[model samples]
Target: MTNPPEKTPENPWGPQNSSPEQPFGQQPVQGQPAADPYGQPQYGQPQQPAADPYGQPQYGQPQQPAADPYGQPQYGQPAAQDPNAMANPYAQQGNGQPGYGQMAYGPTPALTSWIKRVGSHLIDWAPITIINRITDPMIGGYDYASKTERVGTNPTLGFILLVVGFAWFIWNMVFKDGKTGVSLGRQVLGIQLVNADTGQPVGAGKAFLRQIAHILDTISCLIGYLFPLWDSRRQTFADKICNTLVIDTK
Candidate 1:
C-alpha cells in the first residue's frame, strides 16, 4: 500500500516558521488560568472586608483613634460619643459613689426590734371569746372550743386543749408537704415564714428545730407567750429565740 501524503504548512504561523504545529496558533498547557500583576483574582472585583450593620468598622479591641480638633469623629469615622452617657451598653452602673465599696445609707425600720411574723390565721386556732349570745355556726362560741367556756372549764377539757394546742403548733411548724407552719392556712392567710438573714422559705428542718426550742418559751408557765400582749409587734418569746421572721408573702 502507498504511504499517506505528508501535510504542507499553509501560513507564517505554521510549522514552516518557528511556531509549533498545534490547533489555532496555541501552545502546550493552554488550560492554565491567567495571573494578574499582584497574582490575585481580578476583573474590577475587589477583596471583601467585613463590616458591622451600621457600616462602622470593628477590630479585636475598641478603637481610640485620634479625635478631630473640634472633638468630633474623625472625617471618615462614626459619630462622637458623650462621656457622661453610657460607655458600654452592657456594663452595669448604679447611683452610688464610684468605688469598690458601696454603702447603703437610710433609716433602719423602727420596728426592727420585733422580728417574728405570724399569720392572722393562727387566730382561727386560738380559743375564741364570746360576748353576745353567740350565733356564728362555723365558730359559734357556745361550743366547748369557745374561749370563755374553755377558760373556766373542767380540768379534763383544759388537758385535752393543751394536747390539741401542742399538736396544732407542732403540725404547723414542721412536717407539712416538706414545708413548715400550717402550710395551707398560712397560704390562704397571705403569709409565709422565712429565715431572717437569707430571706428563704422555712423548711422542715428549721421548723423541727424551732419546735424543739418552744420549751424555753414555756419556761414560766407559758407566761412569756402572752408577752406579745404588751409588746409592739406582738412576737412571742419563741419567735425571738429563733432568727426567723414572718412576712406578707402575698
Candidate 2:
C-alpha cells in the first residue's frame, strides 16, 4: 500500500485534516481562521473590536421606567378614589325615588269658595229661624221686626228659646263640626273644616270657640264672610281667629 501523506508544522493533522466532516464545506487549518458557516465572522474572529465600550445603547443612559398600561395600582401605592360617588346617606336612591325623611312634591289642596261658604251658613241658620217662628205663638206671638226685639220683650219665653237654641247650636256646630269638621250644609256643599296647622278635625272645644268667634265676623260689616272670595286659605274672620281652614273635599 502507498504511504499516507506525512504531517507538517503548517498542517499539523496532515492533509487529511484539510477536509473536515462539516456539512457544507472543508475544515480550517490549525492556526488559520475558519470561514463562518453563515457567511459572517466566526466565534474567534477578533471579537468585533470590543463592541465600542461606550457606543449606541450606552450604560447609565436614562431609560424611562416601563409605563403602567392598565392603570393598575403600583406595588407600594394606594389606589385613587372615584370623585363622582354620592357622599350623602339620604340622597336619592338608585331607582330614582326619594330616600328617608325626604318629602315628595304633590299638588296643593283646593280651598272652599265664598259662594259655597255663604250657602252653608244660610243652611245652618235656617233651622234656628224656623224654630223661632214656630215658637212665636207660645211667647205671646207678637209680630216683632227682628229676633232680638222679640226676645227682649218675653223674658220667660226668651229663656226657654235660649236654652233650646244653645242645645241646637251645640248639636250642629260643636259635636257635628268637631267629629267630622263638617256641618250639614258643609257636607252638602262638599267642603270640610280642619285645624289650619294640623289638617284635621277641630275638637269640641275648638268648634265651640269657632262658633263663638262667628259673632266677630258678623259684626265686621259682614266683610268677614266676603273675605274667602280673595283669601288664600278661604278663611273668614272666624276661621282666622279659630285657626281653621275650609277646604273643598270634592
Candidate 3:
C-alpha cells in the first residue's frame, strides 16, 4: 500500500479541515454556528413571537370582559324593566268626567205659543157646541133661533147633554192624549201635551188631573187662560199645578 499523506501542523484532522473552497458536505467547526440548510434562523436570536393578531395578555393582569354589541343584559344579569303593566287610553280619567257621546244632564223642551193654544181650545169646543145646538129640539122641545137663547131651556135635557159632552171631553183628553199626546184640536193645531219633567207623553191619569185643575184656572176670571202670553215656559195656572207642558208637535 502507498503511504498516506502526512498530517499538517495547521490541521489537526488532516484532509478533513473544512475550508471555504470545499464548503459542501462539510462538518461544522467546534464553538461556531452551523450553516442553515433551509434558510431558517440560527440559534441566539429568538424569532420575535409571531406578531399577535389579537392583543397580547399582560402577565399578572386581570382580563377585561367583552363588550355587548346589542346592549342586552349579560347572560346571568337581571333585566332593566318589568315585563307586565301595559298601558290603556280610554279608561276613566280624573274626577269621573263623562265619556264620549254621553250626556251629563237631561234635555229641555220647547214650549207652545199662546195663539196656538187658544186656537186649539176653540176648535175643540166648537164641535161640542154645534152638536148641542143641533140635538136641542129632540131632547128638550125648546126652539130658539139663536144659540144664546138655547141655554137653560129644559134643564133635564140640558143636564143630560152636558153629562154626555163632559164624558166625551174626558175620553178625548185622557185616553187619546195619553196614547198620542194629542187631541183632535191639538193635533189640528200641530201641538202635543207632555209631562213637564220627563218630556214624554202625559198618561191618562195625569191628563185627568190636568183637566180637573182647569176648573181652578177658569175660576180665576180667565186669567189662567191668558197667563201663557208672558210665561217663560208657556205654562198657565193649570199647567203649573199638573206638571204638564203643551209643545208644538211640528
Candidate 4:
C-alpha cells in the first residue's frame, strides 16, 4: 500500500504570485494590465508625462530668454537719454565750417580794436619814415622836364638807403608776419593777423597780395581802413577780400 501525497493549499490571492513556473517574480494574468516595474500609472487611468531632467522647453516650442537684472533698453527699443544736457559755449556749429564770423578750428578770439591797429601801423612805418626824412637832404628830387634829377651831393648813398628801407618793410610786413602771424609792430601791440578760416598764419604769397589789396582801403576815402570802428567783425575791405582777421593776443 503506497502513502498518499498530502494536498497543497491553493493561493487565496490572484495568479500574480510566485509559483513553480514563475520562480523569480509574479506573472500578470492574461487580458489584464501588467504592474509597472517602476510604479507607473496602471491601466484604465490617465497617464502623467515624465518630468524633464534639464527643465528645458519641449520640442517645437520657442525658447524664452532669461530675465535681465538691470533695467536697460531691450532689442528694437529706443535708448534713454538725459533730458537736461548742458550746452557747451565754445562748441562749433554748422559742421565746423567757418562762416562769415566763425573760426574753422578754435573758438573765435577777441578782435583787435581800431586804435590798436593804428598804433601797430605807426610802429611798423616809423623806422622807414625816419630813415627817409634823414636822407631827404641828400637824395635827388624827381625832375619832370629835364629827366636829370640829382639835387643833393650824396644821391647814390641816399638811393641805397631808400632801397634798404623798402626791403626792410617787405621783410617785416610780408615774410615775417606771414610766417609767424605777427610782425614786429603787432608783437609789440600783442596782436596777430591770421586767416579767418584757419585761424593760422597766411603764407608769404597771400601776405604780399594782402598788401596790394590795401589799395581798396584807400580807394574809398580811407573808409575801408576805418571799417573796424563800426564793422561787426572789425574787418576792413582788404581784410574781407583777403579773409584775414586781426585778433588780440593779450
lDDT of each: 0.53, 0.77, 0.76, 0.84
Winner on lDDT (3 vs 4) = 4
Error of 4 at 174 (Å): 0.5
lDDT of each residue in 136-222, candidate 4, tens digit only = 868868667778765886988888889989998899999999999898999999999999977889989888889899999999999
> CA lDDT of 243 in candidate 3?
86
Best candidate (score: TM-score) = 4
220, model 2: CA deviation in Å? 1.4
Candidate 2 lDDT score relative to the true structure: 0.77
| lDDT by residue (tens digit), candidate 1, 86-174 | 46534435754343433334442233222223334344344322311131332323345544532232445544555665565556547
Better of 1 and 3 by TM-score: 3
Winner by lDDT: 4
Task: Please give each candidate's TM-score.
Answer: 0.33, 0.51, 0.49, 0.56
Tens-digit lDDT track for model 2 on 1-250? Answer: 9999997568444445445453333455577676655556776566443344545443556543454788666667787665885578778989988888675545656888888888888888888887776556556544456544333456577568867876888898789989898998899999888988777899899999988888887898888877888887788888989899988899
Model 3 has an lDDT value of 0.76
Candidates ranked by TM-score, best first?
4, 2, 3, 1
Question: Which parts of model 2 are misplaced by more than 4 Å?
Answer: 1-106, 141-162
- Worst lDDT run of 10 residues, candidate 2, spans 49-58
